[model samples]
Target: MAKCDACGTTILFGGKRMGDQRYCNDTCAGQGVLLNRVRQIPDGDVVAFANQVHSGNCPKCSGQGPVDVRDSYQVWSAILFTRWKSTPHILCRRCGVKAQAGDLAISAVAGWWGFPWGLLMTPVQVGRNIWSMAVAHNPNQPSDALLRQARLILAQRSLQDGRSQG
Candidate 1:
């Protein structure tokens, strides 16, 4: 058995292979690619790149004080299967609040149809969205996860620019 490169899950059988790295699924493969890109950036440069992103405008609304927010929503069908999704967004406080409101509404409406998992996850996701909204109320600085994502974005852009010039 081989351990997944992105997430350390024991792979019992066939798995997606990218070069020498093996991943359990497509999502893991995509994450592995991103991890590789992030690794290309030097450790000393991460803080500088994050600072640059912090000073820049929000990618969505072009507003200041952009912060990272992740909201989870759940949906279940036929008392058998449950689907949950967590989406991350980098937006100003106003935009983040709007997005969280949508997630909250959706989770409240569609998150309680299935079995034990749906019952268990619905309230949790709803509370999580509420918490995210409360945190977004005071957008002072970018969160650490936001800073890391910013560094990754800047590093990817720089690599693309270098490739284009060469």
Candidate 2:
């Protein structure tokens, strides 16, 4: 068994491989990632760049092993609906339009159970929040009516896909 160079944890099967495979899992892997992203430190001559990462806890479900969104319809369905990352703008494939990011929350909201609930939450609700945030952030992007229609389209698409497959 290979031991992680950083944490000394035994590298399990499927853990990412690097230089004989350090770090037992992605959390540890992130430490190295964060370290690398910060180029300079100290001496009063340093600025930290923003670290962009998918918000919320690990989305993978573990049972019998680690099951990812790709493995099950339910998981994949959630992934299809969930926003992977926040961007200042996104390219819309439908109309070939570029959209400015709205006032969407930068972090995923947690439910009463202390778990990431945004993915499990309704896409219409989430999408509405995103659309509202978007229009509020930049009125130049699209009208609220147009954004609402887009959100409904996305939510409906997800529902249709889920029903068709699951």
Candidate 3:
């Protein structure tokens, strides 16, 4: 007898069992394996940037400005996935415009594919991004630690560049 990892069901009747499959069912198995995208990606800069931008601070210079907020997300999987989602973002008007342009550029590139999948996906994503930008004004200030880290990174890069040039 094995206990299902997800639902705590006692598995005593199924003969199609081999080894200790912590999850007693397929649904449980899928739920157990599927993870948050950010955690899966584990990119420090991406996470940090997301945090900074959504903090109601200017994303580029981290200064004060007329606040704007946008939420957009895209989910992509090689083998049948939801394909797109929503992400929240905050930025100044200038940064918002820049973000819109960048998103539009990405959508344009995808649209260039001009075929079944790309055609479908690009239009959907483009509309979503457009809406995200249009609705963008909304949060807390970023943590001091994050700001300090950015400053340190910039200082380190400048030091290395100076040394290399000299």
Q: What is the lDDT of residue 123 in candidate 2?
A: 46
What do the candidate models score in CA lDDT, each in turn? 0.75, 0.34, 0.53
Model 1: residues with Cα > 4 Å off, grouped in runs: 13-33, 70-78, 136-140, 158-166
- What lDDT does candidate 2 reach at residue 5? 51
Question: Which regions of candidate 2 fall more than 4 Å away from where they truly are?
Answer: 18-21, 38-166
On residues 109-161, what C-alpha lDDT tens digit does candidate 1 reach at each position?
A: 88888788788888988888888777543345556776677667866687678
Tens-digit lDDT string for candidate 3 (1-166) = 7776556788776522323446767776644433222233334664465465445557566777544354453433233332444454455666656666676666666443544556567667777767765653433544343444444444445555767999
**For candidate 3, what is the TM-score?**
0.39
How do all the candidates rank in terms of TM-score, highest first? Answer: 1, 3, 2
Ranking by lDDT: 1, 3, 2
Candidate 1 matches the true fold with a TM-score of: 0.75
Candidate closest to the true structure, highest TM-score: 1
Top-lDDT candidate index: 1
- How many Å off is the CA of 26 in candidate 2? 1.5
